[model samples]
Target: MRTSRDAPTRRIRAAVVGTGAIAAGSHLPALAALAAEGGLEVVAAVDVDTGAVQRFCADGGVPHGYTDLGRMLAEQRPDLVCICTPPTLHREQTVAALRAGAWVWCEKPPVPSLADFDAVEAEEGQEDDGGPYASIVFQHRFGSGARHVRRLIADGALGRPLVAHCQTTWYRDAAYYAVPWRGRWDTEGGGPAMGHGIHQTDLLLDLLGPWSEVRAMAGRLVHDVQTEDVSTALVRFGGGALATVVNSVLSPDEVSRIRIDCERATVELTHLYGHGNDNWRITPAPGVPAGEAAAWRDFGPDVPSSHLAQLRELVASMRAGQRPRSSGADGRTSLELVTALYKSAFTDTTVRAGDIGPGDPFYTALHGGAPGWAPAPATYEEASA
Candidate 1:
């Protein structure tokens, strides 16, 4: 085999938990690409459903299949594990993998609550240990457009950000919630706010730094789900920027959009789920130069936002013996924002950073331990047809 001056790193052993939609659609494909390039091997697959595991392993070319996560962890002893399960299962599966001496790549909504998320983060070891770190898949922040915009802000091209708006308005009929874990507070955390819109909102938070406070409201408007199908919030950033956030699963012409008004220009990104350069636009403030406006839209290389982009970075970080981007701490920012939004919405009051800590009811449950809204009477066929 051809080799570089430095010895090539061994292929990292990897396992996957949950043989579901996200695993098939995103994570599995990304892992397969990495495996093909000789960075890692998909050593094991685990799921509660035996049939699902069998099919996933066969289809994905994973070497071993197991029904029990513990068994897979022990037998395969993978260096990395992908927790592609539901939000509720993420904490348990991640902690187990960490304890088993594997770094974890977890899907978004890493845990249902801040209390649980902190617990999982605690399982990660210090940097010197070459540890058992966990990286959350917040892929939207990895795209070239986002990277270019971030550089613009850093270079004072956009000037101080003044105001912003974020929207994740998508449609999901009652049939979509037929899946057992789809909309319940206990299993899925919150509704569109937690599950669907989280991607855009996380990207919003990624661009704007820390937030100071939020006032929000949520309602179980259309779907019969236990959580809110639509919600809105007004946020105050520590940097003095104010943003309005809206999340809904009711719009037919679904779109994820975020617009930021800065001193020099107005920057906007619009797309559903993921984005490429075409989704971004910049309008300069009246006094700003046209050249700067043109430069804003000229993101050099094209990199679309996707799981594969993040996975490549995660694998590279592992090889460099560094904690990956969107590590536990980085992910907690978005989770904390979610928790605070729930606290503000449910209570009809302002919620600040550090307000939803250990003893706060919102820390453990998004609904503050209150009983979730009972699912309204609705049938999947009736809604779908």
Candidate 2:
């Protein structure tokens, strides 16, 4: 791996923080693929646990390992940093990377709250200038299926998107929440709505555009965890479309789905974790020509939504010196939607897109001062015990 001093411009220096399952399972593999293509070099890995960091770096063939993120950033000065740390660390790590002049690709629930997200945003370079920007991992918005649907909706081929339903219902038992950060508000952010459902919800927002308001309900239906195990919301989009959202961890029939009822056709995606063109179906309204509907089904080659898909786009953006998707306003919009969902559920009032900001309590935390709503997460020691 050549350094920027001698390497071609397309081959960037990259690092990973947090040697957790996500870093190992998703981020590292994506980086490896990109590295094989000479797009970027995986230079270093960082973690709180020295042993874990060493194992991660050694097993992944990353050249350097450090226990401190600051030390790694200072030493390597990577051009891109993939942050797979827990939610609590996202804002700080992203800010640090951006401050170090590295572009950031942080995992979902980007930060615990809108304020933290905004704070990370403040560290970014201006749009016209070369970045040092922070991008969030919302990979569901990529792949050919999502792109096809988004283009159809945007071009009015799907006609006006009148109504939609988004669901992220996957089963998780007590053992799943055994991790210290898994069920905590202060750590993992919030339950399925923030940690799990944010993927599908972000894709929903990406396809449907800005949301006008949300009225939601959330509860701890099954798990003894501090956060809600289930949540539902009625969201109104700025374009006058309405969507019903259901996020849960108690479903036996596991699925992640988004169905939109448009004037000309009804488009739906049904899949578990990630989706491909095969998981998508488009049905034209009665009397609409089957030929026109066939054209709508042309999603081209299948590209399942994955870390690699979004990572490829990010690397391309880095090469072109352009802002990538799931960054800046796009990334913040998803976090804001999740925040408003929580606030609306807790307050039992409709919350708008701009309702939560610097002064708003929800802007700072998902709990948002709602009476008796603060979750007390178990300490790491207790969780491990």
Candidate 3:
């Protein structure tokens, strides 16, 4: 429902929760940039650790900081709230903010499980008009490369996408796993599949379609952690398209790539050093007509940082009385894919998407919390220290 004329003239008042690495590294900077551009104004910050929140405010010159989220919401009444907490805390905090009448932009892996997502969804429907509408942070979808690929597919330039392969091979050492929630089944969700490879998985889902079935295997091959460090899955899309995914935190070097083979051509992209698509390759089928080759055009620099672009969109949607591009329902789809993967891994069989829903036992177990899965206490002390 948002119109172009609704572009925010003054800063849209905003607040942020969780002052950890992600908040400092991405959300804060992105919001600050938007504030400079007259898109958003960060009014307050909240975190369980009072010292951390105070320090962050001091460094960023923020006006207010609070240890309690409810108090901050009551006092600030921000139009926007950024949930930068871990995957486990996303559902509860996001729902709280939504109930408090603040629009929410939560980081990726919006919920640890599908049941949690359902809880949030149910609450979303019950909230008043002034309450927040939630959106998950899947920034890669905002990238030019992703958009270009989507355009090609939508325009039938790539023909019918038949098979897709996604790979996210990265390294996470003991030092990385030293954090309390880095490699846990409970607090951090699964492992590399949920934590590291989720970005690429989201991109795959964005380009292709929703998954219908998944067969997967997972193991903790490298890290001294409870969750799997490496995982792979065979996914079947709704339109009979087949796909494969490889996610790992133990590769010698990091290589993030996706290849989609369509009926007419093959599209590929690689983001080696970071999340940016630095290299792209498109190849047409052999003996294809010249006109088809001409249709394949390379796009120019149009990539915006996902966090910044999504935040801009969120603000725009709020001003226009419209919903965000990635809503809670959209987030639930991705989480369902993840849940299918986990179920497939545990049972050593293919798991259908329909088999896991709000009332299913698997769904119940996921939200009920995984018992005997706590990381060593030293990890907490190290993270807090």
Candidate 4:
């Protein structure tokens, strides 16, 4: 377990890899916030494209930037590394950082397949001296409303969890796919399901539990992409809890919502882009005893809204010699569900989570196998209409 004395006081030295959308939007801003408070420092930023890294640093007020990861790792030796690279590159970069004695907080989806995750796990196992711990970035878990809901479930205030419904509807214009890795199966992994939906999916797995089985269908409904623009799945949790996931990048408007139905009551949350916890609704079943209903209503205080909250927690854990709230193993569970969905879509059958292990043939085939999907046409009218 980590202790408070272990926390770095003179600013935690940090490095960032990749200069893409996520790096620019989420990770950079959060790290900048920490730097402003003197809690963290951005020591080095790296990208395969030097110009991109330099431009990002110029705009973000960062001083050091590099194109080669090895050179940066050898020279800077940052205490923490933030990997904002592509999905396929996560495993390799994470292992590289960890082996170099840097704690890694990488973006998701962690890896394209379970096989790759096994390789990362193997690398982690070889480390005898415990210095830097590794974790995955599932920032949605830090959202105030999500954390409150998790606490309520833990306290048994919601009673037995029976069912959950999650909807992730976000728009991705044709120009969004114009980028080389935007919607490609081999490069970006999967489309909306793996990219956007993975956030909510990770939250679902975090709040509920590991899924036991999954049956899913995916298709290129709108975007000109090699993966699904829209997908749906029916999931069965370990304790027989049922859930449904609806993810789409083709929706006309964007909205993210989750509804959990418990034995005693139900809770619903609706948060639009840029509107975190400002909008939420909780409704209990009718005809319930007033006392229980009131207790449920007064169970807790409102949660705060901040993406940096989890990062703070991670730093605290490192100081206290404890594991972060969401460890690499926990992060892998959501990815496992994603892999299972892809496998189910390809086989046209239900897939059990345990059946898709590292040694499974389906799991191994996913590494080099081409996605059985094609991109939609440039114009929706030309393709669908």
TM-score of each: 0.93, 0.95, 0.89, 0.88
Better of 1 and 4 by lDDT: 1
Model 1, runs deviating above 4 Å: 1-8, 370-385
RMSD of 4: 5.2
Better of 3 and 4 by TM-score: 3
Task: Give all candidate RMSDs, comma-separated.
Answer: 5.1, 3.2, 4.3, 5.2
lDDT of 4: 0.76
lDDT of 3: 0.79
Best by TM-score: 2
Expressed as tens digits, the lDDT of each residue in 129-209 for candidate 2 is 767678899999999999989999999987899999999999998899998778888898899999999999999999999
Q: Go through the candidates in order and give the clash count of each.
A: 0, 0, 0, 7
Ranking by lDDT: 2, 1, 3, 4
Worst 10 residues of 1 by lDDT: 1-10
Model 4, residue 366: displacement in angstroms?
4.7
Per-residue lDDT of 280-376 in model 1, one digit per residue for the tens? 9999989877786787879988999999889888877777667787887788888888888888887778999888888888888888865454334
Clash list (residue pairs), candidate 4: 1-321, 2-320, 2-321, 2-322, 3-319, 3-320, 3-321
Return the candidate ranking by TM-score, descending. Answer: 2, 1, 3, 4
